[model samples]
Target: MNRNILKVTLLAATLGLVSGAAFAEDYRQNPFTLTYKNAITENVVGKVNIHAVNYALNGVNIVANVYTPANYDPSKQYPAIVVAHPNGGVKEQVAGLYAQRLAEMGYITIAADAAYQGGSGGEPRNIDKPSHRIEDIHGMADFISQYPGVDATELGLLGICGGGGYSLKAAQTDKRFKSVATLSMFNSGLVRRNGYVNSQTDTIQERLKQASEARALEASSGEIRYTGDAQLTDEQIAKLPFELYREGFIYYGKTHAHPNSTFRYTVSSLLELMSFDATNNIDLINQPLLMIAGSKADSLYMTQDAFIKASGADSKELFLIDGATHIQTYWNPEYVDKAVSKLTEFYGKNL
Candidate 1:
């Protein structure tokens, strides 16, 4: 049997007969990247209201991109949003698009490069820490309000993928935010440690074991080995469980390749994600919430589980885009109008 087929078969078997692979799966599709030449760019633009503002949260320098609405005004304050990007992603990715789009909708939006990745500061690149990541949201709120056009009182938070998970985590404790929302919100701790919905009973244990083993090697040789993303061939890519990855190479490899994006994250730090648990404290959040995901997203279940768990969430709604997959929402124009409209309505009503 071919390796691709073998891998697919094994993954399907591992997922059991439940068809876990079928949820509006867009994991293979790369969400559209922000480019100046694109037609849409003319609709959305950003002024460097703040550049490299350093927030020493968890001993890392967090960088943020703040975008104000088209008509400038320092005389009056406006609602603000703190947007966090996806895992292994940067500020220039999909989060920036959402931030800019929301700004165009009349809100001051700030997109940040999570600490230890992209433009943010951290020694070992791509180490995901639960608390630190949550604080990054708060730090973004802190940094953005200082800008001239933002209203400190009317605040909201948005996160995509892993950042979505961290946003959920942030909202639990920081009631300072008037409204909280997520796009394809993933429970970073659960998925990173358990492989989506507690499926891998030993994921955390196994991850810890591997980290321990890697530490021993570093101790002996003073050399660190980071396990990065699994590189796949075209043949292997064709059989990816999540089509998003297969589609990703087309964008990341050709269209969006950047000098700083060669990052493959440290393998030794995979265990860091195992320590994060955003859902465990959902009962503490007391705010209006909106959870949006494609009806077909395999990752949709995680959002469902989270929306159900959050306590004191009387003002909450879960909206699913029919026929849309997880990655397609990133920037396909596939469902951008619907997603953006729904968001505008939600924010317009609550904020």
Candidate 2:
């Protein structure tokens, strides 16, 4: 299918106007439409349960899932963690997996869809602006901190993929997060502005000009242009240059696909994305920090660069999942287990 047709299909699915055996097959096991392995099917007494939630963020209705620990008690205090989803990802994917996993480890955790993406409310859909993305993390912190039984003073953060970069920016000024962590950290701004591995450095100005034109077009005629909305064939996906993109397609497009998740973002968003860098104010985060990435991930350099520049962190550590790739850290059983174990250790001590 072409990009425009895919967009129409997505819009139809979102509006409940489309349904098929594929949708039924994908979501039959879980009423919540959670795609993770071993997802919670229902709320059982004295067991981990997920609460679907929606809250207003600057007039946009942000959709999220809050996972309460087993035998959760409202009268008692518990540390909370806010989980940010990856770019083009929804709360029901890997973010929900980690949130549920962390809740199982005895912390109240939340995973929310970012504004203009996933199930969240926003116009000019898929804006993908850095400022809005960073605020989504803060909004999650705000809501989760006030949840029943939550100890407002004890809060942690976990960002995956593109969300990792926004989390870094959020933790810089949002001191409410006492502990911060990232898995398979991806610097979205760096990659977007400079292209993956700086391969598009020569075309930076040319692309910026196109973004400017897109913005102008939108302003004058209310027309929105999108990018990165391609539907690639399996053979085409296999030929992608980067392992992150190659494996990512299999993860997000097939095995764990959710109708709400997508890659399309307004082309005009590049106006803001090109000027933003996650590591710009790295020295502002004074909390304990832990960053984990796959040792073999093509994206490892991003984690290493950010780790080295986090000079203001009270303490910091970089962990590598042996023999794992970037996307593997998201869902591979061994890698996910390793990442979660380290996160439990980090948040346990810090939060």
Candidate 3:
């Protein structure tokens, strides 16, 4: 038991460079180890990390990070991947980690904060409409495709968590993404409408009513309300019943905390979220599709459901990481390595 505990502790330290306790209380003091201890930086060898890139999308200024492979040269074209961050997440967290890893694997990658959240410019901040989020993925494809040394024909896409759902919707319409992949997919629309694991089925109508009311207030220029905005103590977070929510709070609210990651969306946004379904019209995606999820993640159902609905993809696969939970796939070294290895192979074959 002692050896097992030590192994886990060693794994966490190697992934994020902070002790488990510091993950909850001293995130800021840690050495910028959101996912990996030696994340790409300006001075890093074999990789380059560009920050605060400004781009226009539907009249909004979007902030994004672009990662280029080692020894990248503009004269030489390269395959690229656009990574979409999870809901309430920023470009600097899990998205950046994958972007960096992919970059190291010889693919140019971009991870952008959604238009209305993080460091991006949008009014009534934290608005989490599905259309807007889907547009963000499309926007990344547009911006990154034109970047120097990027071969537009070989472009690929990866979306994590809620972003995974949006990617499915975006790839359905945007053929620019030659290959599409999702990690630990979260069906935001299904959850918002029926609740996690269908636990709120009885409250569906009641919750829709609240969403309607919130939208009405927004239209009338009244105070904008928000949901999923809670301030919980460490103990409270630890005691949360669901592993996804519990680990999410620790990742976005504590250990991997960033100033722009609030993890809240305007309550009115649910009006759109509830009505949007990523699996709707999923058959339009004819490109290669890869859906990855943790074997033990409760959220695996989302990936499976979406994969089943994506009938039009000529080539598709569902890969699962053994012994991992949803959030664990984000930072757990063993799981992350497995996920990235699979992604590299998928993109290498498809793109």
Give the per-residue lDDT digits (tens) of candidate 3, residues 159-251.
999999999999998998999999999988888776667655676566667778778888888788766555667776666556787777777
Higher-scoring candidate on lDDT, 1 or 3: 3
In the range 77-135, model 1's lDDT, one tens digit per residue, is 89988888776666765777787778778888888877777778887665556666777
lDDT of 1: 0.67
Candidate order, TM-score descending = 2, 3, 1
TM-score of 3: 0.90
- Residues 237-343 of candidate 2 have per-residue lDDT tens digits of 67767788777777777777788888778878889988989999899999999999999998899999999999999999999999999988878889999999999
| TM-score per candidate | 0.81, 0.93, 0.90
Which structure among the candidates has the greatest TM-score?
Answer: 2
Question: CA lDDT, every prediction?
Answer: 0.67, 0.86, 0.80
Give the Å shift of residue 157 in candidate 3.
0.6
- lDDT winner between 2 and 3, please give it: 2
Instruction: Provide the lowest-lDDT 10-residue window in model 1.
Output: 12-21
List clashing residue pairs in candidate 2.
none
Q: Which stretches of candidate 3 lie over 4 Å from their true place?
A: 1-21, 24-36
